[model samples]
Target: MTILHVSAVKSWGGGENHIETLCYELKQSNPEIKNIVLCVENTLFHERLNETEIEFQTAPLAYNLDLRFSFKIIALCKNKKVDLIHIHDPSAIALTIIADKFASLPPFIFSKKTSFPIKNKKLTLYKYNYYKIKKYLCVSEETRRVTVESIKVKDKVITVYQGTSITNKSSETDFLLRKKFDIDESKKIVGLIGNHIRAKNLETFIETVNIIVNIKKRTDIIFVQIGSFTDRTEDLIAKVHELKLENFIHFIGYIPKASNFIPQFDALLMTSQSEGIPEVIFESFYHKKPVISTNVGGIPEILQDGINGLLTKKQDSAMLSEKIIHLFNNKELAEKFVTISYEKLITNFTASVMAQKTLKEYKNILNGN
Candidate 1:
């Protein structure tokens, strides 16, 4: 059976990365499973997909809600004899809702990656149709709950914690990656990996950096900001310059393969307004790295403060800074957190577990079970 994966944007950002990773793992599980990705035309992600063997298609419209693209999706689904359609975003889901009427209905799945406030009537209608649609594959428990409570979707939601394939020991010898970023050999490195956008709480993160620098007075302390931004890169750069955090912070624009460097960080950081369960958190823990994340989304489900990892209030720069500084000051506590996080990842977030659960749901949905 063919599976048609669709998204509104063509960028290989967080959501796109999740889709690619799932498709890769699904293909590995069943080599005969035909998989194809569909996105808007003329985007960088389309070019990036060319690097992989995964087949690709494009819609002739911007990511906006357009009825015309429904016909295009219908024709492609019919031509490919697609048995499953996994729409990755609300916009694409909106298009799919209309397309399903005109096209051969497939087992449609929607993965809600973001917790955006819905105001558009058309989108709300699509959200309401969750029961009528096929399974709702949520990336986090909180996401599934939100669909039930906020979006008013019924019991059709299924939680699939985001999975990462990286698993290896970090060589304490390879400290040169820190040196390359101008970080001191002796100082511990803390990292924040996500878009450099304002909504990601970059300003608060930078403020936290300033506090850490001031309290520690150790120039060896380095903070790494990985991933690129949209709509606010220039402003973020300007703010970094204004804050004069040049020596303390390193902003390495969107890393296509960030796992290669994730091992070097002593700890990982996340400060965002919203999220499903972030894939990076699982990856960091899988790599045996501790985290200092803001309390948001499904983070509470995964992180128990003073246990696995430290969690602070969202946008609270002082608490975030204090936790990082504490992790730096107390090596014993940091090591404990890292130890438990690793155990948790190994037990609950294995890629095989995620895949098997997903396949079971797919089969059940198909069998009308």
Candidate 2:
């Protein structure tokens, strides 16, 4: 089976990482299935794919409706004889709709990696419910549920949880978090990983840190955020300074293989107002670090509050702060959470398991089941 993966995103994130993990797993487990990527030229995804053995091609995405990108899609579909086109993001879905106008492209398998409800707009609705799209692979059940409300055929939407590749799991990173930041050995590190975006709710992260450090007067715990910086970063930093949290909160902008630093963190903190189960949670599971996240999206599907991990209400700084402190203070509870998380990762949430389920769906789609 020959598959062409499409990603029009300029920056790297969980969705991009999902494509990488899926392709790598397919190559190892099912070598007969050929997977190739078509990403925006000169983008971070394009740059990262160049480092891997994965076969890929790029087209200039100068604008949303760039004909150049659609033309490249036409050429690849015909020249490569792609059996299926797996669209990774919403932008790529719109691009594919444009490409289909000029050529009879292969059947599509669109992956809905976020839980954002489909907007009630004519063009947006048409693009999402496009005729050629045979399957909608949702990252989580919550995502699938939201997607079904927008899709014409409810049966087309299926939950296929995105997972992390665990083959290279390690704690040996040269970039030591404690040493580089000059953090005291006695201090516990709480790690947050996500780009500066509205969905991530980084402002809430800052507020939670303020409550823990200033209001609560906890000096032993420090926060280290790692992700791509954006225009919102300056404002976040300003808020940190305004709250006098410069000493407690540290923003260590984008680091490649940031998950490698998971071992250094005492716990993983996610303040996302929305999500489709961020990959960092799975990474933390593999690293055996306790997690505390907002009760949004499919996070609750995996992170049962106080069982494997803790979950707080969205944007609730006081509750989030309390959970973080509670997790850190109770050593036995922390140990229990990590143990359950690690077991769950190996049993249900590994890349190998995710690939096997996805491959089954691909076969069913081709067989017209």
Candidate 3:
């Protein structure tokens, strides 16, 4: 089966990581399957494939309606004899619609990795319904439900949790992650990983740190955020400065395979206002680390309040601080959370398992099932 994976996202996040991992696993599982990845030029995703032998190509996609890029997509579909087109972003879906007019492209498959509702518009409906979308592989049950509510394609949607590699990831050296940041090992470290964006709700995380440090007088705890700067970056950084949290909070920019460094953290923190099934959550599980995240989107589906992890309401910095402190002080509870999450990760959310499930769906779709 020949599949063309299309993604136009410029930034690298869980969605990008999902695409890369899915493609790599697909190639490894079935070397006969001609899997090709089409990513935007100069993106973090593009740079990530440089050392790998994955069959990848690049296109300079500027907008959702770039006809030139659309033409290239059509050419790849025809020349590569692509039996399926698995897109990783909304922009790539738009390209599929534009290509539908001028070429007899293959059936499209889209992975909905976020709970954000599809916009209700004539054009939006046309883009989704007009194309031959075989299946909507949602990363979570919540995503599937939201997709059904937002679009008229209920039968086409299926919940396929984006499984992660549970195998331990080895870093290059004895990573002195805290030493480089000048953070002492004796202090408790909480880490957040994601792009500095509105959805990530990094401001709330910073505010929670501010409260933990200044209000609670817990100078022994240091909060570190690792991610790329988005449009809302200046405001987030400015908030840190205004709160006098420069020393307490460290904004460590984007680092690939961040979980390798996360073993140093006391607990993983995610203040996202939105998510599907966060890959980092699974990473923390593999590392035997607990997570404190906002109860948004599909987080609750994975993070049981007192079971695998702790969850608080969105934008609730005070409550978030409380959860953070709870994890820090309660050793038994923290260890229990880690143990339970790791068990689930091994049993269900593994890369090999995801590949088998996804490949089965692909085969079924190809067989007219």
Candidate 4:
């Protein structure tokens, strides 16, 4: 089977990471199934793909409705004899719909990787319900629920949890977080990995840091954020300065293989206001690190409160701070959380399992099941 994966996103984030992971796993498990990626030219996704052996092609997306991108899609589909098209983001859905207008493309398997509600609009509804889309593989159960609300055929939407690849599990890194950031060796490092986007709720991250350091007077913990810096970053930095957390917080912008740093962290912190389940949680599980996240999206599906990890309400800085401190002080509890998380990841959430389930969907779709 030949699959052409589409992603119109410009920056690298969880959705982009999912595509990379899926392709890599599919290649390893089913080599006969050819996977080709079509990403925006010169974008971060394109750059990352260039580093991998994954077969990928790029088209320019200078605007929302760039026919250049559509033309490229047409050429790829015809030349490759593509069996299916997997749309990884909403933008790609629109682009693929446009491409289909000029050419008869393969059936689409759209992956709903976020919990944001589908907008109730004419074009939006039409694009989503487009005839060619065969399956809606959601990242989490919450994502599947949100998608079914707007989808015409509820059966088309199903939850397929995205998992992390554990091919090379190691704590090896060129530099230590403490030495690189000049943090004290005695301080506990709390890591947050996500681009500086509004959905990440970085403002709440800043607020949590403030409450922990300034209000609660905790000098034993440090916050290290690793992700792409965006326009929202300036405001986040300003908030950190305003709260007098310059020394307490470190924004390590856009590190490649950021998950490699997860093993070094005392714990993983996620303050997302929304999610389809961040891949970081799975990575933390593979790294055997305790996680503390806002109870949103598919997170609660995997992270049982006080069982595998701790979950707090979105934007609740006070509660988030308390959880962080609680995890820090309770060593036995942290060990228990990590143990359960690692077992869950190995048993149910590995990339190999994700690929097998996805491959089954592909076969069912092709066999007209």
Candidate 5:
């Protein structure tokens, strides 16, 4: 079976990371599948593939209506005898819809990664429910439910959780954080690892810190945030400053290989408004760190209250701060939670598991089942 994976996004994030991991696993485990990645030239995904031996081709795409782009993809499919097209993002979906209209194309499989519901618009439905889109590989049950609800196509959607893989790399690279910040042993670091995007709800984390330090009068927890700040970052920083918790709050902009630094965190926190089951939670499991997340999207599916990880109502900083305090107070419970999460990670959230489930879907669709 031959498949052409298309990703035209210039920015790199979890979606791109998942694409790279799935491609790597497919090449290693299913050598006969003839996996090829088609992306924009010199982009992050393209550069990442260069580090591996996986075959990929890069072609520039400027706009959604680029007729030449459609023709190019059609030509590539014909020349390479590509069996199926797996497009990653919305932009790539538009490309495939246009390309399929112009050529005798293979089936298209859409990978849905977000929990956000589809917009109730004609164009949105038409684009997603395109004639050639044979299957939908959703990253979580929440994502699948939304996709089906929005598209009104229930039979085609399937949930497949994103798998996580961590290489036991050295933490020498992360020493720069401790050295640069001059953090001491007395500080208990509670970290939130993600971008400053709206979905991340970083203001909640900052507000939770205020509750812990100012309201609760806790002096030990040092809140550290990784990932790059975006347009909404100023408000978060100003809030932290206004609350006078700046001394305890630290922002370390984007770093490479974040998992290496995750182990240094005493606990992991996710204050997102929405998600399709974040990979960072799985990484924390592998790192043996207790996780605390808001109960939204597929987060509650993996975070079982006090069993494996603590869950709070979305946007409830009081409850979140309480969970944080509880985890710190009950060391044995936190350790047990992390251990249970690690067990779940090995049973359901590994790269091999993800790749195998995805391959099964590919084969089922390819065989016309």
Candidate 6:
């Protein structure tokens, strides 16, 4: 079977990472399954794709909703005789919805990533495109629920949790990651990794950091945020400065290798107000580290309330701070949670499992099963 992917970005975001992991696993499972990624040119993720065995197709994607790209994409899909087309983002979905109508379109699959509420225009467009597609995929159950309501989709959306490729055991040397930042080795590092988008809820994470430091008076814990600076980062930086958290919190901008850096933290904290099965959840679990995340999206599906990790109410800094401190003080509990979380990742969320499920989905769609 041949699959062609239409992705709006070549940047190393959660969605791109998921796509790369999926392609890598699919290649490993079945060499005969031809898979290719089509993305806009000249981005770092696009260059990284060059290092992989999966094929690449670069085109000038105007705005994400660019219909002009349909001709180019349709030609590529036809030339490759792609049996399936998986649209990774709304922009690509718009293009596919257009291309399929006028061309010899393959069975199209759309990955529904957005779960947050939206305007009626966006909903209408999604509903229109969704009804025209052969299959729909959601990265999390929350995503499926929110998307169904927003788009009024009656179709059953498949939930495929984002999987990770990391399998290395946490080493004592992992602690040296803080030393690289010139941070004191004795200081505990609490961290979250993502781009500086407002939707990621960076402001709330900063608030949680302040609360944790103030309540514990523990100058020993440093809250570190590693990610690329987005448009909202300036405001976040201003907030940090105003809160006098310059010493307590550090922002390390955009590291290329996510796993190499994120696993170094004592705990991974996700303060996002929204997400669809974040890739970092799997990465942290694989590294045998506990996480404190907001109870949003499909996070609860992967992390049990008190078993695998801790969850805080969305935008609740006080609750988040308490959970972080709880994990820090109770090392044994943290370790147990990490161990269980790792087992969960191995048993349920892995590239191999995702690829197998995806292949089955493809067969089912083709057979109308």
Clash count per candidate: 0, 0, 0, 0, 0, 1
lDDT of 6: 0.79
Instruction: Give the poorly placed runs of model 2, Cα more than 4 Å off.
Output: none
lDDT of 5 by residue, 1-369 (tens): 888988877656678778877877887788888888887777666776787787888887666566666776788899899989988888888877888777778988889988988888898889998877888998888888888987656798998899886443345564655556666887778888888898889988988999999999999898889886678888888888899987889988776666668778899999999898888888898888999999888888788998999999889999999999999989898889988998999898887789898899888888897
For candidate 5, list the clashing residue pairs, or say none.
none
lDDT of 1 at 13: 69
Query: Model 2: how far is 76 from its true place, Å?
Result: 0.8
lDDT of each: 0.76, 0.92, 0.84, 0.92, 0.84, 0.79
TM-score of 5: 0.92
Q: Which residue pairs show collisions in model 6?
A: 227-254
Residues 1-369 of candidate 6 have per-residue lDDT tens digits of: 888888877467888877888888888778888888888777767877887777988877667656657876888887888888888877677777778777868777778765664446955556444655766678888887776665545565667766787533234343356666677878788879888876689989988988877666767888888788878888889988988889888887776665666567888999999888888888888877789999888989999878889998899999998888888888898888989998999899987887788878877877876
Per-residue lDDT of model 1, residues 176-199, tens digit only? 556677666687778788876555
Those runs of model 1 whose alpha carbons end farther than 4 Å from true positions after fitting are 66-69, 117-123, 127-132, 150-153, 166-176, 215-218
How far in Å is the alpha carbon of 262 misplaced in model 2? Answer: 0.5
Q: For each candidate, what TM-score against the reference?
A: 0.90, 0.98, 0.97, 0.98, 0.92, 0.92
- Candidate 1 lDDT trough over 10 residues, lowest sum: 166-175
Put down candidate 4 lDDT per residue, 107-208, tens digits, no spaces: 999999999999999999999999889999998999999999999999999988899999956677778999887888799999999999989999999999
How much is the lDDT of residue 168 in candidate 5? 35
The list of candidate 5 runs beyond 4 A from truth reads: 41-43, 61-72, 166-176
Q: Return the lDDT, model 1, position 198.
A: 55
Q: Which scores higher on TM-score, 2 or 5? A: 2
Please write out the lDDT profile of model 3 over residues 229-256, one tens digit for every residue: 8778888889899989998888877777
Better of 4 and 6 by TM-score: 4
Q: What is candidate 4's local distance difference test score?
A: 0.92
